[model samples]
Target: MNLHSPSSTVADADLQERGGAPATWLPAVAEGLDIRRIFVAFRRRFRLFAAVALAVLLAVILVTLQATPKYTATANVMLDTRKERVSNVEEVLSGLPADSSAVDTEVEILKSRQLAERVVKGLKLEEDPEFNAAVRKPSGVKMLLGGIASLVGAKAPNLPQANSVEAQKLHEEVVDAVLDGLSVKRAGLTYVINVNYESDSPTKAAIIANKFAELYLLEQMEAKFDATQQATTWLNSRLGELRGQVQTDEAAVQQYKIANNLLSASGTNLTEQEISNYNLTLSQARAQVAEDQARLSTARSQLSRGSSGDDVGEALSSPVVQKLREQRAAVSAQVADLQGRYGERHPEMLKAKRQLSDIDTQIQDEIQRIISNLQAKAQVSSQRAAAVSGSLGGARGTLAANSRAMVRLNELQRNADASRTLYESYLNRYKETSTQGGLEQSDARVVSKAKIPTSQSSPKVALNLALGLVLAVGAGIGAVLLAEMLDAGLATAEDVERRLDTSYLGAIPLLASVAEGRTEAPIDYVMAKPLSSFSEAFRNLRTSVLYSRLGEPVKVVAITSALPGEGKTTTSICLARSAALQGAKVLVVDCDLRRRTVNRMLEAEPEIGLLEVLNGEATLEQTITLDAPSGAYILPLSKSNFTPKDVFGSVAMDKLLADLRQRYDLVILDTAPVLPVADTRVLAPKADVVVFLARWRKTPQHAIEAAFRLLSGTGAHVGGVALTQMDMKQQTKYGYGDPGYYYAEYKKYYVS
Candidate 1:
């Protein structure tokens, strides 16, 4: 007898399962997602992707078709800051420098309420049917939302009324709407500005755009004109005041001059001329006095020396005086010679003396005339000096008086000069302003007028459709991934083995009868058609179970699941039949007292089963029935009024399993789900190997883990896990794992 202990098999199977390579779908133990698995997931959930994509595409199409078309027209305005008035005064006083922020300012002005209002008024958009429709006719989407809200007992919003207050409100609303549709942008760094307006009516759009350009230019011209006019008016007023100030200043200067007696003659003041004349005449009189004094001293010296006036400068300078002096000298020499030769009364000496006496008399006459002339000249010089000195004293007094008044006179003159200069400057500015007032020019011009659009600008069909397609595809992929994440079902054998940490025995394909639309009672395909792929899968599972134990062949194998409807009973029946077909004696026992399905699958009519045997009302031999097709013994649980706990807890249940193990080569027990009841837990310790069954793509991974935890807590020997009722075609199509592909690749080998 091959007696296998549950501990030894469990230890060996754990080592074998753990030693196997990690599942390809989950290559790592961390949070890394395998791309291959992701592809499989998406492929498996392709229906969800298709449905989502189709729905999104349909919605996009509907919205695009129902959207209202709009036309846009643009007018170009050249904001030439260089175009300005050619007035130097205007440039200096009122012109602004070229500012970089001017473009942004112009854009804001274009978007301003005033400009919008002007456009509205010019086009009479308030009265246009198209413009009014935007306010009156609500969009379809909004109407639908409103209807939905009404159904939920919400009040719809009220529309504006056509009254004075509401009319004003509506007028403002239209202006705002116009503003909203307007777009103003600078064309690169150039001076050209594009003003675009969109509306339902092409003509209205064009008219509004053109009007905005025209209004902007007109506004600029008006602003410049107003500035020039203001400058002119201020200059005119200032000019009048300056003219009066100039007159007053000149008058004050003249009055100050007259009050101070600061009179002038021929560019020279009166006091200054009199002082010049007095100085000149005084200088000449002093010189004459000095000349007369010198001449009188010289004449008196000549008379005292008895040399007469012959040696004197004045007498010598006279021709008559010089001739008389010569005659006297000759007579003196003759008298001296006669006196020396003869006595005092000699006749020649007497005659010579007489001649000398006569000559001396003539010389005396000449000297007397010279002395008299010198006295007359000296007297005239003294009188002239006295008269000029008195006149100089009067001129010096007048000059002193004029000096005292010059300070105030100078201040008045400076005031007059400043006033005259300022008056002339203002007069020139006023004249320039008056001339430039008529020459003010605008800084912007309409370079291009807006024309009526021939085509709609909104609801770009091709672009919208392409974008919708891209979004739909993205949404579809997103939905698929989300569904894959939310669903934690074990889809493949790898999921059961790797995630649940269990041995993967094999996968049982879904029965062909079910696939072929034959809904009859499920049969053990191993017994019905032993050579089929389904039967072959069970045979493989049987081989794995036998080899699970290292030192001994496995006996008393228990098949169970996390929850009900995992096909545990079907798997157990098929495995038993496969073991029996190998010429091994196998007994299939139905341990689910609550829901007995094995007996139904085998068409067993035995009234006594494991429950009855455990209760001591029947023996194992009496309760067990032999199936004719498979020749396998089946111990069904008949209808009993006993709880699973009561039956599975009995000592007779252990004895019955021990006796069945001795009697059969292999025993298969189909127990209740580990999650729902304690029947599997109670029977698990009695079996040599425990096989956990997970329905393909149906059992949740957490559910299987929980079941394994429960069984492990109870010290049950979990041999391995089996994936049941798998669709091989779908598994291969989605590339779920290696098992499906292996089965597909070797399908022909199993056909014979």
Candidate 2:
């Protein structure tokens, strides 16, 4: 059994001193996620969700119906990478590069303010009311507001004019309007561009789109033409300068040649030729000198050695020297023969000796003559060699001078050649550019001209309706979640255990009018119809209190709530009558000195009640009243001026409880709300168990928690929280697994 009371051995005085009831067992199923709880939450707040969803859907329908439709036209333009070349000459203004960045740049140019201004001016859009707000008629809403302002003595806002401060503002506004309707984008990974324009008129949209494409190509052509004209002019001036430079350089070359006499014939200088001839003559003369000197030296050497010149090279070659040498040899031979044949003084021998002597003398003289002629030839050859060398040196000096002059000549010639080369190149380029100047062409062309659209592009009814449906659902769900979060009322038995962390004893179904249309108070109705669900609820409450204490029987049960008008007195009366009907001796006590609603509920007019009894002015027998219908005794309170805490917290109140416990099988105390008065707090400790009352779907969770806190502080045994005034009809919608949720389906079990 649940521990809902103090120990049997523990008295009320001891419980009051302890300042809290024994801990009761709480249900373990109170924690964890439960899909049923979420379903019940949404079910309970379905009305709010439906209202929100319908409102949002209605708003969507209205807006979609009123929206203006627009027509869009698109034009395709591609950068012509395969361009036509009219000439081989390169233009000053090159075509746009075929790359993604260049394409993106062109896209931006299409959206440029300058382009937008041109389109607006060309189309005369500034005069059209669609593009110019200043010229447009005021809408109905604006006119209404303006009328109201005039009625209230307010001046109308000034419209923009040509000479006003807002003139530039109006011009910019028109440009912005044009740009706003125009869209330019490059097709993915291609040089193709898409230009689109939207307007109320299909013709206007197509015209604007086509106009933008036409102007873009025109702009490119104009740019190229202007660049080519500038290039031709610059080239003309540069060619003039180059021609003058060439002439000056060539003239300088000729003047330098004349000043230095570096003139040449047949591409060869006269001084150079003379030097060459002199070099050749000098070489031959030296060779002749060397040969003549060698011959003379040989002759002189042979003569010095006393040889007869017969061994000399020149003498050997001479015919006279050969003849003389032969004669000398013959005479010597004759002398030799004569000496051998006769005596030393013989006459033939003397003649032969004289002949030999004559031959020797003539041979020596011939060798001498050969030596003198070699000396003369050597001297003449030496003189000629010296003369040739002198002439060659003179020619070399002249050649050196000419070579020095050639240095300046070569530099001048190189300058003239460079200037002439530059002039010729520029002259050729000028001719090409001048011929191609009239042939400029644009690098872009329109691939597909914009056509007038057959259908409007905006205010799509189907898509808007679908989106509105989704938004409505989302808004409805959000509202349901918000309502659940903000609702703090405890609606079901699960809330008692989960939110308050307390036991859930049972729920008391609210008594509804039957077919007779007769209504009865909860206490009176239960006694009149004991077999009904209303009476059965109290019987169940009585049983829960008795069995909740386990070994300790619950003799005293206090009924209290977080606030007033929670049916605490009714519950107390009904519970007491319920126990009485079960053959248990039951007594009802109204412990509220401030309100004393029990007397009014029971229709008892006792002059002196609990206040008098506690003050010893009236005995229990005199103050207590008996309801003959339920056979239950009531101890009601009358109007009192005394403080409730002083009375309920007194020793007399404790003694009274001890006395009632012995006489009655069960005692029910109807006490004031815990937060409003201290009477319940003081009386709660003296009770065996405290039955906290929470109005179904009425009592806030925080209020119940606060009431329990006060009751526990007084060491009261909180048997459990009982839900009072629960409407069974409406409870089925909650589906919270509470007794009231199934009350209708199981109503046949009870007789009304």
Candidate 3:
């Protein structure tokens, strides 16, 4: 006998304490997952992962081998944005810096349809098999779709004929295709650009790439040349207009000069010279007037004092006056000698005095002549000064008029100078532009020409295989996890305790014959093979049932499940046989009236059973059928007129259970499923203990909870739950139950 109670190591109180806070179902599921469990899941599903990886890898290999090979070639062009302008004139066309917008514009130009069409026409790609689909073979996808449509009784669309309109449209299509294959990118942080093209032929790819670079350079040159020509034309027209303006301005300046009388004789203004001469003449006249006034005053003073000749300057300086003075002095000396020699009235003395008188008269005549000359000189000097002063005043008035005329002359001169300056400027620019027009150079040039590639660019074999393997493995793992999450079956004893909030008594291992091969009646096999794993598991279940209640053994136990086909009948029969083997009288009563499986398992056709005994048609002993091999009395369910609810709910049913409990040491009632019918619920309240059976990894958690609710609603004392038909190998593989622990730690102690 393997009688045992719920382990003291994990009592109901211990489980409640360890569970801590009451968690909802989702958290309980999250708590169940751990690194160990993930590892186990991956290990269990590794074959699926490998199969998926193999299939994907094989497909990758096929594609890599059969795919059409394409070749890519690149031509490098250097965009010299730092353009060296050879002239100082403002450029009408200039290169831009390698900013984002400039680079983007360059990229668009390289990818433009016009440029692509030019390339297509130059290469005659409209008739080329590579670029023109009309000339090329149909693609595999198109062929497959065509075949499918044909099988479905539908016709494929025909290709359009290449007429003039269609040819033009086809030409555009070819250009678009070429554009799609072209890629332009700036070589990082530099003015160099890379032009790449893909094609079926390496030589063709190289040819197209080199051609594109050449075309771009030619385009740049043409644009620059055109801009230079336009600038030259405009400058020429402007220069002609400026020349006419300059001539008109000069003529206007000359006309203004003539009208204002601004021209001067002797190349210098006459009014200015006249003003200078008049100023000099006025100064001379004023000096002469002063000299005459001084002379006149001197003469007047001399006349008043009877010494006019002496006071006059000319008289004082005259030689005749000096001679007269000397003669008079000699006469005075003779007169004095005669007076001394002879007395008064001598003839010699009188003659000397007369000589003195003559000398005095001559001196007086010279003085008068000097005075008359001074008067005439003063009159002429006064008249000349007055004439000079009047001329000076007239010259000053003319100078003032000339100064006012100068302002208007200056304005006309400024206009003439500005017009001449502008004409010269335009003329110089026109010359420079004409000289530099034909010498313009493109800012971009081809740095490297594309070469024929030696290897294909597409259908990378190793890379595709590697990627396929990774994706396939990921998908396989995802599928496994999804399947696991969707499954709601109970797999282990821990699941029962965690989900249902009930005690887990023990797990019953599935028999090897039923698990490994075809299905056989397990009740007969357990009796025949007593020492087998199946029998041993049932013995263990019996131990748990016997020790379930604390003070008393569970003598009257009812076995049921949440749903049908959950092994409750098998468990009930096995429990009875296991109890009888422990030297106790046991009775197995089949109370499942709707679908009675106990009689079929027992291999007996009974005339009377529990139904008859409850209806008072047969006694208890008549209803009991003894199984000799297991030493257990069996009461199979018989056909009855009444429904299960009426029979199981009657007072006689309660009395029959009481009497059977008294007679047998253990009365194991095999009841119908709680969720499927009301038989188990009606019978559960009369039993001392109710044991709910849950098929391992098969019964849904909600179904188990519903069954428990149904039984508890009738005040049934549910002792614990037992997991049935568990696969021990799988349990050990997933690390779920005691088998996982025992197989790893104590497998050496048991024979295989």
Candidate 4:
């Protein structure tokens, strides 16, 4: 259902060929439009545009050459942006290193009025006449011109400060001079800038520029170093207050420990010593109890034996004779049994009794000794505890003192470490600065400094001369175009054929003027030399009239025109004579009552003319007079009370024209302007032929149209328009200058 492509029909291509793509070739929106056409058009008419450009160029050169030469000397000084080290420490702020913008700031400061005043004082540029001349106002010239122009209304500049006017003037002069001399150019993508000063003297210019850079750098360094010094002073004052605070804290801690009598001092909330000391005291008591049990056991063994650690088992059996015998029997029986195994009172049996006795005695003594030793140890431990408690009290006091001293010392040490770290940091930064500053890392370097230019860059002579030639030629072409576009008269034979649809009779050459003084009548020239242009024009008119309708000729034809001074009278008189020369009856009538130039140019006898006949004061037959035309007839105007319009429009005037038409073979009427009066209006209707006369370069198009409008209103069958007063010089200027220009190569049978 969709068919889309870059394909176009043949019609589209045709349209594009005829007129560029309507969508894409829009004249208004197109960029970089080809103005080549304009240039070419100017080239074809080059003499004009070039001439204009040349004149302007010459005028500028002349003005430039005549102008007084003012020499300018320029001096360059680099606005160095190298930074200076105020301190070693590099600041970290917002995660960025601090970069000083002071150099740029100084550049601006140097441009300020304060610095300008200083320079003025330093250089005394005001005293320099060259400096004053460089910035002089145009008031002197203005005052002179203003005086002359005052007649047409111009006023002088008003100075407001009347009292201190001279002082203000001097101050203004200095300010103006400084501004003129001072110039600055910033480096591309860099901190360096160029300061330039212009003066008549090269040394002065160089001095000013260099001095600004030096002074500004000094000012910047002082400001930054002073700021650093203030910071150091603040830090030192803070350090002193902290030291005093530490000492006071130490003394308070010591006194608290001495008064409380505490064995140990509280640590800084993280030391573990009390638990270790309690466990050590318990171990010492246990060791004393174990030693006492060992000593008591050895003492009991010494006390147990009757014979030096021996015991008697036979004593019970020997007990005093009988008892001793019974006891002895029991003892002997036991001994016998024992001797059976051990052989008669063996030392093992005695040792067993001795061992049992020793064990019993030792147990009793150990219990006593245990009691004594426990009591003694209890007493000794009591005394030792008292001594330990006493010592611990002293230890608490000493520990508190030491702890207090240690805490104060640590605080001071910590502060000292932080300060030392900061000082080291600054030192490191100073080392870095020493390297960087030495390198002078700025982007722009001076290539070549400005010096005094020997010559001004104005006024090119060859260029101006070339322009003048172009301008002159161009002006000539433009004048021709203007003349053509503005031309209103019918200038060519084609105009007659196109407008009238009639044969082009011919054209007439321009008359030099009545003052050029012709001795003979125009007919004499035509008759004497029929081969001449004047005669040829008349002959062509005669033939065209004769052969127009394939008839005998134009008999009793009246000639009239749209206006006067369009050669209607000349045409009329010439036509009549040319016909009369052919032996035809010819009558010339002066119908123009306003101007009787025909009668005047011909020097015809002054008598009652057309108005007299119309007023019934004279008959047309009776008023006919002659001068230049002896064989021909002329009807001149009478000094009638009637106007040209009245007499021409009257029925009587109609009868008179009819009478001439009937009476003569060729009758010609010279009429007034078809626009100004109804004379031509009345005559236009009556005459068989009506010719409109237009003067070259004189008759305006609108005037011609108005004349034609009058004729058309009257329904006059306007024959054609005739061009009069043609000049060959004027014709050549407009490229399509003459009708013959179309056929210059072709040999034309005729030309008007």
lDDT of each: 0.76, 0.81, 0.76, 0.54
Candidate 2: tens digits of C-alpha lDDT, residues 482-571:
766555666777666655656888888778722134477777887888888788888888888888778997898888889998889888
Assess candidate 1 and give its lDDT. Answer: 0.76
Report the C-alpha lDDT of model 3 over 553-610, residue by residue, as the tens digit: 6789899889899888888888788767777899988888877788777767677777
Write one digit per residue (lDDT tens) for candidate 1, span 1-752: 11224564464366346543223344432568677676766677789999999899889989999988989999998877675536566432343335657776887887889877877887788876565553466788988986886565434245323345667887887877778778999888777889998888899889889999999877777787887788778878988898898899889988877876667523338778888888888898899889888888877987788875667788778878678777777878787887888967999988988888888788778778878888999899999999888888987776776575776777878888998999888888777777875576667778999999999998888988999899899999888757655556666656655556567787777875223453443464455567767778888898888888778768899899999998988888778777777888988888887778876666555666676777778887787788767778888877654562567767887788778878999999888999988778888878888888888777876677667767776667787888887878877744455667555677766532
Ranking by TM-score: 2, 3, 1, 4
Clashes of each: 0, 1, 3, 11
Residue-wise lDDT of candidate 4 within 1-752, one digit each (tens)? 00011232343345335432222112223445545522433444456555555566566567656755443443333444344445444422111112336445545665777667667767776776655643445478877875676554423354334426755677667866776667665555444566766655556666666555555445445544554455455555555665565565656555654665533635533222542353355445444445544444443444454332212222212223224234435554555566578864589666554544554455444445444654575567656655555655665566565576466555645656666566555555444433333222222234345554565322344554566556655665565344333344454554433323334555555533211344555655545544545555566676655554353345544455555667777777776777677677788888777778676667654667777788898776688875344367788875544462466677897787777777887777777777776767767777666655666546654466456656666755555555665553333322142453333343244332
How many clashing residue pairs, candidate 3? Answer: 3
Model 4 lDDT on a 0 to 1 scale: 0.54
Q: For model 2, where is the 10-residue window of minimal lDDT?
A: 20-29
TM-score of each: 0.61, 0.64, 0.62, 0.49
Candidate 4 global TM-score:
0.49
Name the runs in model 4 displaced over 4 angstroms.
Answer: 1-58, 70-123, 131-163, 173-448, 458-506, 511-524, 541-566, 615-619, 625-631, 640-645, 729-752
Error of 4 at 49 (Å): 10
C-alpha positional error of residue 187 in candidate 2 after TM-score superposition, expressed in Å:
3.6
Best by lDDT: 2
Better of 1 and 4 by TM-score: 1
Give Cα distance to truth, residue 545, candidate 2, Å. Answer: 2.2
Superposition TM-score, candidate 3 onto the true structure: 0.62
